[model samples]
Target: MVLPAVGDVDRMKRRIQSPDYRDWRKKVEDIYGCLHPVRLTGLWEIADKTSGEVLKSTSGHILAPCGNRRESVCPACSDRYAADAFHLLRAGLSGGSKGIPVEVADKPRLFVTLTAPSFGPVHNRRFTASGKQAPCRCGRYHHERDPLIGQPIDPDGYDYVRHVLWQAHSGKLWNRFTVALRRQLARAAGIPVREFADHARLSYAKVAEFQRRGVIHFHAVIRLDGPHGAVDATPSWGTTELLADAVRAAHAATHVTMKAFTIDGVPVRFTWGDQVDVRPIRAADAHQVEQADGTISDDRIASYVAKYATKGTGKSEAADRPIRSRAQIELLRTTEHHKQIMRTAWDLGAPVVCPDCHPDGPHRVDGCGCARIDHCATCDNGGYIPGPLDELNLRRWTHMLAFRGHFLSKSRAYSTTFKRLREDRQIWRFEQNLAELGVTADSVTVINHWDMTSVGHRSDEERELAAAIAERTRAARKHRYQTERTD
Candidate 1:
C-alpha cells in the first residue's frame, strides 16, 4: 500500500528513505501513535541483586506514551484511558476482577446522572414521549447537528458568571453530594448518620461530561457495599429501592453555598438540575444495554460511561491547553458563544496588568484599582468581582471554563486506579524485554535512567504522520473487535 501525500511530501519521502524507518514504524505501533511522544535517550539494566552483576543491558531511544486522557489531544492515549476506565468500572460493578469479590454483583447499584441547572433558555432539539420531534422555542425544528442548538437564544440574559462559578466548584459540589448520600443512606436505614459507614459503604466511579451548552454534568455508577467494601455483605435493609431513594434525596439536598466566592455580593448556591436519572444496573451477562426490563446491562455500561472519560469540554468548543491570554481566546477558530464563555473565564481568572493598581506587577485586588468606585476596563464590572477566583488559580484552567478537577474520579474502594493499571502494563512490557534478552534470573533489580530530548515531533510532517498512524490504529482495533463479535 502507498501512503497519502501529506506535509512537505519530499521531506516525508526522505523520512521513509531512512534506514531506521522500519524501526521507527515499529516503535510508533508500540506506543499507538502517541501525538506528542516524549523522546527519551537512556540506558536500562537488569542486574543481579546479590552479586551486582549485570544480566542484561540496553541503551537507545524510546517513544513513551504522552498519557493525555483527552481525545482532542491524543486519540491513542485517550483510547488507553477509556480501556483502563472500563476495567476499573467493570471491576467494581461485576466484582470478579481487581480483587473485588463476586458477591458485589448482587449489591444494589445505580447509574446516576446529575445535570447542571439551566442558566437560561438555549436552542435545543427535543423529543416528546411518543417519539415525535418537538419544535424548539425558536419556532423551528433544528437539525440534529446544528451548531446553534446548544447556544442561548438570548445571550444577554444568560447567567455566564454563575455558570462559570458552578463549573469551577463542581468538584466541591460532588464532594458535598457524597456526604449527603451517606446521610440519606443512614436516614433510610434508620441508623445514626455518623455510623453509616459502620453499616454500609458507598462506592462510586464518576465521569464528568460537558453538555452542548458548555455546562458540566456527571455520570456515575454508585454501588452500595457493606462496611468491609466489595467483599462484605450489605445490611439486610439495603435494597435497590432504598438506594434509589437515598440517591434522590441526596441529589435534592446536595447544594453548595459558595460563601467564599460571590456574584453581586450574593453567594451563588449551586444545585443539580431537575433532570435527575437513576437506574439499576444488571449483571455482566445481559444481552442488551437496555434490556426488556428497565435496568441496564453492566457489560455495556462500563464502555458506555468510560467513553466520556476521553471527551473534551465540548467538541470544537474548547481548546486542549490552558488559555495564556485574552488574545489567545480571540484567535481561537470556534463559535462566538464558546469564545465568549472562554473570554469571561479569562477576564475573571487572570489579573490585569494595569499601570495604576499593579504598578509593581499584576495584582487582582491589592490596591483596589479595578473596583466599582474606579473604572477599570479590564475585569471588574458593575457588581461583579471575582474575589477568590484569582486565588483559586482560575487562570490555569480558563480553557476548561475554570473547571480544575479530574475528569474521572472514584472512591478508594471502587476498584483499581489508573496508576496501578499503567504500572501493570509497564511490568508486563518489562518482563517481555527480559524474555527477549535471554535473562532467566528470577532475582534481579531493574534500573532505568532516561532524559527527555524533547516533546512532540520535530516537524509538521512528523506530527501529521504520527496522527495518521494513531487514527489507523484506532480504526483497526474497532474493526477487529466488531469482527470478533460477529464471528
Candidate 2:
C-alpha cells in the first residue's frame, strides 16, 4: 500500500510538471471537465481572412464532444442539452428570444398529449376526479413508485407484436396526424387544405416520451400563427376554441394504415389509441386564477416537455443503447413484457423467403430460365428477401423497443434550433476569448483538422477526478441559481 501511494504521488507530480498538462487542463475546463472525454489528435489554424496572415496555430489534443443526449450516457451533456431545450421551448411559449416577438406569447397555445393506442390491458395507477387515489382492478393499491405499474396483468396475453409495430411506425403516424390536424383546421375555417396555408399556419414543438408501459407518447406545445408563420399575427377567425375543436376532430379522424401486411392471414392496422388529452396552456399570471382542473400552465408545460427531452426510455424499460445481438437481448434488464416486445421486433425484422418469388416451390437457382434473368420479377431482387415488417427497420431500434422517432422535434417556425443555440454560444465564447487575448482584428477565420485519437478516460483515477470536478461545477451552478431565486 505504501509503495502504491508513493507511486501515485510521483506520477501526479510528473503529470503536473509536464508541458502539455496546462493545455490538457484548459481543454478539460472548457468542457467543464467532462467525465468521459473523447481524445483527439489534430491541428487548428486561425488566420486573418482578408490579410491571409496566420493568427495562431496549435495541435489539438484531447477533446470531448457532447457525449449524448441521454442522461444515462452522460449527465453533464444531457443537462446542457436539456437547458437548451428548455430555452427553445420557453421561447415559443413566453417569446422574447431567438427573434420571436414577445406578443406571440399571448397567441392561441395548447398543451397536447397524443398517446399510443392500448394494445392490451396493463397495470396502471388511477385517480378519481376529486384527486383521490383509486385502487387498481387487481384489488391492490400500488405504491407511487411501483415498478410493476406498467406491466401487463397477464404478460402472456399482451399484444407485443402490435405494440412494437406501433412503436416502429410512430413517426409516420405523427406525420399523418399533423396533416389531418391542418385539414381539420382548414375545414373549421371553411377553407380548403391547400388554401388553409394561405390563411393561417400551425406551428408546434413536440417531444416523444416513453410511457410506463414501454410505448411512445407525444407531448407538444401547439400554436396557431398567421399565414406568414410566427412573424405575423394569427387571423381573427383562429381562436383557442376553434383550435381545440380542430384538435379533437383531427384526433378522432386521423389513422395510419401500415404498408399492408398480413400477419397470420389477418390484416393488421395501426391507429392512435382512444385516449387523447388536449388542454389549453394558460399564461403565468392566469395560472394563479385558473381552476385546478386538467388545465396546465405554460411554464409547467415547457418544463415538463424539456424534462422528457433529456431522457431516453424511462428507467423501467430497456437499456439506452442499441441491442445488437441475441446475447444482449437475453441479458437485458427489462421486464418480460418488454423482452417479448423486443423479441417480436427481431422476429419480424428477420429476413424471410419472398412469397411471390418462391411460390409453390423451394428456393431454386437461376437455372430456371425465367424472363427476368437479372432479378426475380415478383420480389424484384431475390427469393430470400426482407420481410414486410422488416421494411420498418425494427431490428435497428430494438433498444428503443422498435421506436425509431426523434426524441424531440419542432415545426420550422416554432423557435430557434439547437444547432443555432450551440453556434451562438460558441461565437460568444470565441469573442470573449479574443477580447481576453487583446486581439483587435476585424475578422478571423479558423481552419481545423481533427481526428479522433481515443475515447473515454485513460484510467479510473482520471474518470473519478473528472466526475468530481463536474459535480462541483453543477453544485456551484445550483447554488448560484438558488441565490438568484432567493434575491
The candidate that wins on lDDT is 1
Off by over 4 Å in 1: 1-9, 48-54, 313-316, 350-386, 435-442
Q: After superposition, how far is residue 353 of candidate 2 from its true place, in Å?
A: 3.1
**lDDT (Cα, 0-100) at 55 in candidate 2:** 76
Tens digits of lDDT, candidate 1, 1-487: 9988775548888887889888887888889999889989999999988899888886899888888877878888888888898899889998778788888888899999999999999999989999999999988899999989889989999888888888888899999999999999999888999999899899999998888898889999999988988888989999999999999999999988867766788887999899999999977777677766679988788878887777642243788788888899888877777887887887777544555434455445555544424654544443234445676576788788667788889999888888998898888888897788776648778888999998886777778888999999999999988888731
TM-score each candidate: 0.89, 0.87
**The 10-residue segment with the lowest total lDDT in model 1:** 378-387
Query: What lDDT does the true structure give each of the candidates?
Result: 0.83, 0.79
Instruction: Please give the lDDT score for candidate 2.
Output: 0.79
Give a tens-digit lDDT track for model 2, residues 1-487: 3554443365555655879767766777677757667888988877877898877777857577555776666667767888899989988887878878877777888888899998888888889999998988776788978988898888878888889888888898889888999999998888888999899989999899888898999988899999888888999989988998888888888776764786687777788888888888776554431347766666666778898887642242777777777568888777877888888888888778766656545565653433335667666765677766766888898888898888889999888999999899988977876786567546877887889878887766566666666777778877986787521
